[model samples]
Target chain A: MHYFIELFFSGLTRGAIYALIALGYTMVYGIIGLINFAHGEIYMIGAFTSYIVASVLSLYGYPLFATVIIAGAAAVVWSGAYGYTVERLAYRPLRRAPRLSPLISAIGMSILLQNYVFLAQTSDFISFPKLIPDLPFMDRYADYLGSSDVVILFTTLIVMGILTFIIRYTRIGKAMRATAQDSTMAMLVGINVNRVISATFVIGSGLAAIGGMLIAAHIGQINYYIGFLAGIKAFTAAVLGGIGSIPGAVLGSLVLGLTESFATGYVSSDYEDVFAFTLLVLILIFRPSGLLGKKESQKV
Target chain B: MLKLQNLRAGYGNIIAVDDVSLEVGQGEIVSLIGANGAGKSTVLMTISGVVSCLAGRVLLDDVEIQGLEPDQIVRRGVCQVPEGRHIFPQLTVRENLDMGAFLRRDKKGIRDDIDYVFTLFPILAERRNQDGGTLSGGQQQMLAMSRALMARPSLLLLDEPSMGLAPLMSKQIFKIIKRINADHGTTIFLVEQNANQALHIAHRGYVLENGRIVLAGSGEALLTDPEVQKAYLGI
Candidate 1:
């Protein structure tokens, strides 16, 4: 029972991070129907940005909580800039080309960003600061969940709630939903479809940055290569949830996280990646549209 | 209010509207009537900037808006209620209407327009909270027109507004279209397959056949022309 409880909390924390990252993938896909293969690099950039900010601030003797907040904010801004630039420079030009053209461009972007970071930053792992301060009282419950896990879980819930509110109530949010439904109609209605797509990437990449920062804090280290594996897992989560559905992406991430946690806990950790892929394959075989994806119908 | 001069447009290389030229005067209802493949919708699309003009010019108030993006054209006071009433299926009727005013920022004016739209189509008011896709065919058509009106456009391009509608509903929609033009002084450029009804309501009309304007005159003149009487009026 204790082991199960421990694994559940761990899974929940991991799922929250995955959900955050997966949202970027799902939203970009929802609006533009592009997979945004370079999304993972955005996450990596977020972590690195946070690391740099915190390191620079620590030299000035900033405390842990303040450092964490400032670092997260810096990461959000940096990653958001990257997201907008990637959409404008890399993806925008290929938007009207063959669909496969953008896919190739996205893959190319991912590799280029990865190498860019590798050359700029070190290939060796960087030790992240302990953003979560030590809580002596919670040490007794450390086996069930750490203070970092609790922070990650709560922050994710708050951010997700805020995101839901923005999408539901804001005018821009309505425009986004409208554009996603039918861009031609959206354009005719006077919504700038290009602006809406850019906004999606900006918001999506910001969320990914938060995810990257939180995960870096939790795991105690990050590297340029961390984004590759983490991004693939989050992409899988988005696909599982239903590529275009926001709620579905969140649900899918949790499921993927729990699956990975339990697989690692009970089964050999060596086969963790194997188990995740197997589950995705089985889900695809049974429900190809994904768990919450709408089945497309031919209008004509 | 709107002018097309020697315009040629199409999908890829296949021309759908070739060398088509027409004018829609301010505060008047003008219509383009044609057969199934006569390029009626293409003409409107080219004017609205949805389809790029391969040649010639589109002048909105004589500024030449040819090849501008659709949203830019819309911002310049032309809004198109496209064929098939493309309402956002997942959005409520109210949201769908709000989307029409997406580019506008005047809160009080937007609210007033919503009230005005509701008055025009009371059914939309009743189903304000319902998803637009759930509306009946007639109701959807009403919603589509009302949505365009929310933009407060100077020139409203309505394509096939009466398509798939019952006679009673189509008549009601036409009455409202006339009312909108009269009350708001909005210039209308209508495209329809129902030639008799379209010409009956329009102040002037053009007959488009295979991407060219084969005939043009006052609504009554075209309605009574021998070729139009035979080909369109089915005399």
Candidate 2:
């Protein structure tokens, strides 16, 4: 029972990271129907931003909480600006072009960002400092849970709660839902579809930044290429959960995380990727609309 | 209240509306009648800034609104109930109505407008919480019109409000359009394929053919015109 609980906590932490990344994928896809392949690179940028902020602020000898807060906030702002610029430069112009144009452009952007960061930051892995301090009571169950795990879970829950409130009750949220349904109609009814699309990218990228910062702090290391694998896994999670559904993305990430944890725990750790890929294929074959996706009929 | 002069607009190289000119006076309902592909809908779309005008001017109360963004056009009190009743399917009926007033900031006025919409279509009030997609065709049309009215526009551009409706429901819709114009003094520019019913209610009418206005006259004069009877009324 204790072993399983330990696995559950670990799985939850990993799932939280995947969920944050997957939401960026799902939201950009939802509003504009683009895969936003560059989303993973945005995550990488976040980690880099946080790392730079931490290094610069480390000179001040601030406490762990203050360092994490300042670093995380800087990462969010920088990453969000990157997201907005990416949309305006790469995605916005291709909006009216053939749908394939934007997909190709997104792939190009992913490559561009990866190379740009590699050239500027070097290809070597950078070690990250622990952002969360060890709490006194957590030492009692150190084998089962860590203070970092608690922090990740707490942040994820708070973000999810705040996002839910905004999406459900706010005016901008209603406009977003409306645009997702029918953008042409949304415009006719006076909603600025462009502004809504930009807002979605901003929020999604900010969430990804937080996820990047947390994952880097927890793992204690990051590389320019870390976003590639994380992006693929989160993309898989988004597809597993219904591609456009917010709750579905989180649920899919949890499922993916638990599957990975158990497989690594009981089976050969070398087969982790194989297990995840096989599960994705099986799910696609059995349930093409994903776990929670409703089969939508196109109105001709 | 609304004027389009020599408006030329279309989709990528294919002109849907070619040099069409028209006008709607305040407190009057003007109908633009045509067959499918005659540019009636395109004219409305251009005026509402959904489609760009290639070469011409769209003026709303002497203000050049051509080339303005769609939301900007709506802010200037030119609202369009687009073809096919393009209501947001996932949102509730009440939510759909609220979105119509997206630009307005007056909370009391918005509340009053919503109440007015409900009075216009009581079925909407009853189904305020239901998703717009769940409504039947005629009910959806009502919701679409009500949603547009939520903006409280001085000039309303209605495109094919009677399309895909039963004869009875279409008649009811026409009756409501007349009531809205009479009671509120809204300047209306209506586009419809159902020429007979449209002309019967309109104060003046324009006949569009092949992306141009082929004829224009008072509603009674057009109804009695020999060419109109032969081509549109199917006499």
TM-score attained by model 2: 0.98
Candidate 1, residues B96-125, lDDT tens digits: the string is 998999889999999999999999999889
Worst 10 residues of 1 chain B by lDDT: B43-52
Q: Model 1 residue B32 lDDT?
A: 94
Query: What is the Cα root-mean-square deviation between model 1 and the actual structure?
Result: 1.3
For model 1, residues A131-216, the per-residue Cα lDDT tens digits are 88767887999889988888899999999999999899897888889999999899898888899999999999999999999999
Off by over 4 Å in 1: none
How well does each candidate superpose onto the true structure, as a TM-score?
0.98, 0.98
Which is the leading candidate under lDDT? 1
| Whole-model alpha-carbon lDDT for candidate 2 | 0.91
